[model samples]
Target: MQRFPSAISLFAALSFGMPALAEVTADDVWTNMQAQTRAMGATLTAKQSRTGETVTVEAQTIAWTLPEGIGSLTLTAPGFAMVEQGDGTVQILYQATQTYRMDLVIEGDTATLDVRMDGATPHMTASGDPGDITYSVHVAGGMTAAVSTHAPGEAPVTIDVVVEGGEAEIQYRVTEGPLLAIAGQATSLPGRFDAEMQMGAEVAGTVFGTVGGAESSFELNLPSDGFDILNVAAALRAGLSLDLKSALESSDYTVNLDFYGQPFSEERRWSGANHAHFSLDENRLFYDASGVDAGIVMKGENEFDSPVDIAFEAAAASALLDIPVSGRDDPQPFALRFSFDGLRMGPGLWSLFDPAKAIPRDPASIDLDLSGMVRNRVDLLNFRQFVGDVSGLPEPELISLALSRFAMTGAGTATEATGAFTFDNTDIETFDGLPRPEGAATYEISGVEGLIDTLLSMGAIAQEDALGARLGLGMVTDSVGEDQYRGAVEINEQGHAIVNGQRMR
Candidate 1:
C-alpha cells in the first residue's frame, strides 16, 4: 500500500488561503501545493463505532514524504501547450493519444488538474516486466484531491496486486483563519479546519487471495492553533513530546470499516459527536469521551463446520483513560483508571463451543471499574527516550504498587467480584521475587460445581488435569454456604501465605 500523511495535514495544505492577485498560474498553484505539503503537519482525528461502543483517536500528522519528482511534468510546443482563456484562466494540456492525456486549469484562487491513462502498459522498475494499468488523479484547487485506478489485465502491477475501480477523495475548508488575504500580506500561523475523506478500494492476488469490495471512510473537524502546530512541527523534526491532550480536545470525528471474506467478515462504525474532551496540567492528563456510541457484528465459520454470528451493543456507552504523565515523585502522585458501562454480548456465541447448551444463551452483560496507583519516581514521559536508543535510559527500579479498587459484575448470572492488593518493593521474597504482596483479595462465585461437572462431561479437560486443578483450588478456596463459594488469599511481610484464615505457607 502507498502510505500518505493523515488527511488532516493534507487539508491544512489544501485550505491555506491563496495570495491576493488578479490571476494565478497552474504551475504556481502546483508548486505552492507541493511546498506546503512538504512542510505541513496537523492533528488527525477519527472515531469508530462497533456494536454500541465508540472509540476516538487523535494523532499528530504522520511524517510521510511524496515520491521524488511526483508533480513534475514535461511540456512541448503544440503537443504540450498552455493557452490563456477568455475567462482570465490558463489551461495547460498534454495530448499524444486517446489513452494518454493531461489537463490542468487555473483561475483566480482555484486550480484543477486531471491525468488519465487507459489501456497503457506499465513497466516494472526492477525486472522490466510489463503489466496493464489505468489510473487518474483530479485535484480541485488545493482543498480537494480525488484518485481512481483500475487494472483489468492479469499481469501484476507496481502494487503487486490487481484492483478494480478503486476511488478516493479528500476535501477541506478553513473555518477559523483569515478567509481572505490582503495584497503583500503574510498569512497567519494557525487556524481551524473541517476535512473529510471518501474512499473505496479492493484488491486480490498473491497479496490477499480472492477478496473484493472492501471500503472505508472518515470525517474530521480539527484545529491547528499556534501552540499545537509548533509542537507538531517539532515532533516531525525530533520525534518527541506528543501532546495527546491537545489533539483530542481540538476535534470531533467518525470512521467506518467493512469487509467480506471466506472465513470471516466484520463491520464496525463509531463516532464522537462533539462530546469528546481532554485536559492536561503539567504531567497529568485527563480524558473523557462520554458522547461516543458504537456497535460491531462479526460472522464466520467455526471449526466445527457450523456458522457463527456474534454481536454486541452498548447504550449509554462511554470510555475513559487517565494517566499521570510525569514521574511519581513530581508533586502529583502516579495513578491510572479505565472503565466503561453498558457492555453486552451474547445469545449463543458460547453455544458453538458447548454443543450440550449447558451455558446460558441469554444476553450476557458486564460492568467494570478498575483503578490503581504506583508510588515511585517512575517517569512515563521518559519512555520514548528508550525507543531507538536505550543506552541513555536510567536503571529500572520498583517502589510500590497499590490497587485501590477492583470491581466487576456479570449480568444474567448474578456473579460479582471485588478485591484490592498492595505490594512493597523492598520485600521480593514473600511472593517469589514479586514485590512482596501485603494485601488480601476476596472472590465470590455461584454455580461452582455444576459448571465444573458440565466441563468434565464434555471432555474439555483431561481427567488428570481436572484432578490437579481441583486439588489446587481446594487448597485456596472454601465454601461460604450452599452452592456459593467465597474465599480470601493474603500474603504478609514475613512471606506467609494464608487462605480462608488458615496459613498454607
Candidate 2:
C-alpha cells in the first residue's frame, strides 16, 4: 500500500450515467458491500494468493477516505479494517508501516462501477444488473476488459475480451490516450489461418468522442490464398508475405496500402510489402491491384492473359475516394471476399458518409487491371439493369448466370451515380434494368440537415441539400433495419444513373 493522493483521483473517474447519488459513509463502503452481495446469493470470497508479479501498492491497512481526500487513518483492527456499505458499494483503504493501500472504491448511485486490479489504475466496473459489468483493464501499457455478465450467481463469467493499445483496441476505446497513436495491423486469410496485428494510432480529438484522428505506420502478415477462388488456384504456392505498413493522416488525406507479400507468386516467395502514409483530414483513397495477374475466363479461353509474372506495382495512379471512416473501424484490419447476387454496393459506400452530403463535388477515382476472360454474358453492368449491350461483339449463348470476359486497364471515376464501381471483373457490378423513360429523372434527398458537416467539406455534396435528403432515403425504401437499404435508380444506354443512391441527383 502507498500513501493516498491528496486529490483522491482514484486512478480514474467512472459512472453508469444513472441520476442517483445514494450516500454511504467511508466505513460502510468497506464491509457493507460484501453483506449486500451475499444477500444477492453471490458466492463471493477473498483469499491471499501469491501472484508471480508485484503490485504497485505498498499494501497498507483497509479503510476509506472522505471526499476532501483525508485518507489518514490509524486503524487498531487486525490485518485491515474499514467501513462496510449497503447497496453493495464499499470503500476499503489500508495502512502499512510507512505506506497506504486502497483495496476498493464503490459508488452506490452512478450505476458505473470500477475496481482496481493490483495495478495503479482501475481494472473493472459494474453497472445495471448482475447480467453485465464494464471493465477498463490494462494489459502491458493498454487497457482492455470484457462485457462481464454476472448471470445472478454464475461464477462471474466474462462476455467479451477487448485488448487495446500495443495489442488490440476494442471499438472507439483506446488502451492509451490520444497522445499515443495506435499503430498495429491485423490480417485474416483462408486455410484455417488467422492473425492479429498491432498498429500505432494517435487520436487528436477531444474526450467527448468526436471524429478526426491520426495513425502511425502499422505492419502485419498472415497466411492465406487471397480474395477470390480465382486467386486461390494460382496463389496456393507461397514465395512472399503480405505486409500493411506506412499509414498516417496528413493535411491532404489518409493513406495506407495492403501490399505485404512475396515479390513473386511462385513456390519461392519474396517480401510483398505495401506501405504508405497520407495527410490528415483527407477522406480519399486509391488502390493499386496491377500486380495481380489472374482474371476470369472470356469466350472459353483465358483472356486475362497478361502473363502471370507476378512482379506488379500495377497502376499509374490510385483513386482518391472521399469517404468518411469511423475511428473504431480504421484499425480493425479486416477483409472479406464474399459476393452476393444483385448486391447493390453503391448505397453501402454512400452510407459510409454523413447524409448531409448528397452529391460529392470531389470526384472519387479508381485504377485497376481487368484484362481477363469470361465465356458467358456481359462483364459488368451499371446498377439499374441486366447485362445488356453486346450486339456489336460476338454473341455467346445465354446459359447460366456465368460471367462474360473483357480486358480492362485504366482509371474511371464514380459518376455522380448510385452504383458500385468495379475495376476488376465486371461480374461484380449490378444492373437491374435501365430506368423507365419517364417515371423519374433524378430523386433529390432532403431533411438530412446537419448530419454531414464533415462530408460537406469533403466535396461529397452540398450541406444544405444533404440535410434535406438524409433520412428520407430510408423512409422511401421497402424495409427498415440494419440491412434495409434502397434507392430509386434511373438508367441509360451508357449506364445506370442513380438517384437516392448517389449522384444522388
Candidate 3:
C-alpha cells in the first residue's frame, strides 16, 4: 500500500522537470521523463500520442531490480496526459481512477499487489526552467486506495485506505556539478485504513486504524555519476545525500486475531505528536525518533491460568543513533541514546504477581546515553561477509567510551551511574584477549533493601538468598544516608579491578 504512493510520487517528480516555456514542448517533457528514469537504473516504457496541445502516455510500465539480486519490482500505470497551457506552464491531468499493478519477487517466493487510486478534483501544474522548476500538486476532494495482495500458498490480504485531503510542492534544480537537487514538502489530512486477512479455518485477523494527520518533507542531492537506484552503495560513494523528516499528529488502531478457536484482541491510541528524522551521506548515517502520550490495551488468555486484561498509560520513547559507514585510518565518533518513560501497568497485571500490593507500583523507565570513538578495520557497508566468521577479519577497535548518564527505575527501586573510559588495544592479553579498559565509575542506589524484603515476604526469593544479597551489598557499597547507597568501581592502569579502594586482581 505504501509503495503505491511512493512510486507515484517518484514518477511525478521525474516526469515534470522541464525547461523554460519558450523552449519547452510536450515532447521535451516526455523525453526528459524517460531520460531521468533511465538515469536512475529503471526502465520506463509507454506509448506516446500527441493531438493538438496535449501529449498522452499510456500503458506505462516501470521495472527496477533490487540490489544483490535479492528482489525485483515492476509497476504498471494506466496513463496520464501532459497539456501545454501556452502560458509558460504545463497542466498534468490524471484520470478519475488510476490502477497500478506491482509484482515483486524475493528469493524463491513471489507476491503481487494491485492498487486502485481514486482521486477527486486533483490538480497538478509545473513551471520554470530546466535549471529550476516548481511543481504544485493538490487533491481538494481527497483520495482513496484499494489494495489487494496475493502470494503463493497464502490467503490474499485486502486493504482500503482513505485520505480526506492533501497537497504537495516540489522544487527541482540542476546544480553546477551536474547534481540533481530536489526538495519537497507535503501535508495530508486525516486518514483511515481497514484490512482483513484469513488463512486456513483456524487463522484469521482484522485491522482497523485511523491517522489524525501528517506532514513530511525531504531533501535529496544526487550526483549524475553512478546514480543508480539498484546500486545504493555506489550511489552513496558518488556523493548522494538524503534527509527526511516527518511528524504525525495522532493515531488509533485495533486488531483482532483468532487462532485455533482461541481469540485475542488489542487496541492502541496515541495523542500529541510523534517525530522522526533520517539522514544518510557518504561518511555516516543518522536517525532519531520520538513519540509521546501513547498507550495499549490487550485482552487474551495467559498460561498462568488467568484471564489477561492488561493496559499501559502515557507510554513514550526516544532513540537516536549516529555511526560511520566507511573505514578510515583515524577513529570515527559514534553515539547512541535510547530512553522510555511513563510506563504504568494496569492493576490486573500487577495483581498476578503481587496480590498483596507489597511493591510500589511506580512507573518504570530506563535511559542510556553513550558516545565513543572506534577505528574500523573493515567497511561497514560490506559487513555481511564477516557476519558468521568472527575470526576471519579484525574487529573495529574501541578507542574511548563516555557514559554521560545511565538510569533505571522500577519496583520501588532506582539506580544511576556515570563513567568514562579509554581502551588499551595494544594490551589485549591483560584482559584475556579483550581490550583493557581503564576508568572509574560512580553509582548511587536507593530502596533496594525494601524491595528485597518485599520479594522475600512474597516467597519470590529464599531467606538464604536474601542474606547473601545483603552481604554482597555490604562488601561493595557504603550507606551514604537512610535508604541510600553510594559506591565506586575502578579499573586502574595496572589492570586491577578495585571496588572502594580494595583491589580484586
What's the distance in Å from true for residue 165, model 2? Answer: 12
| Runs in model 2 lying further than 4 Å from the true structure | 1-22, 25-90, 93-412, 418-505
Candidate 3: where are CA atoms >4 Å away?
A: 1-24, 67-71, 106-110, 165-178, 195-204, 223-231, 258-263, 269-271, 301-310, 383-391
How do these models rank on TM-score, best leading? 3, 1, 2
Model with the higher TM-score, candidate 1 or 2: 1
Off by over 4 Å in 1: 1-275, 290-294, 300-308, 315-318, 328-348, 375-384, 387-392, 395-415, 462-469
TM-score of each: 0.49, 0.19, 0.88
Best by lDDT: 3
lDDT of 1 at 297: 57
User: What global local distance difference test value does model 2 have?
Assistant: 0.25
* Candidates' C-alpha lDDT: 0.37, 0.25, 0.73
For residue 190, give model 3's deviation from the true position in Å: 3.2
**Best prediction by TM-score:** 3
Better of 2 and 3 by TM-score: 3
Worst 10 residues of 3 by lDDT: 14-23
Q: Sort every candidate by lDDT, greatest first.
A: 3, 1, 2
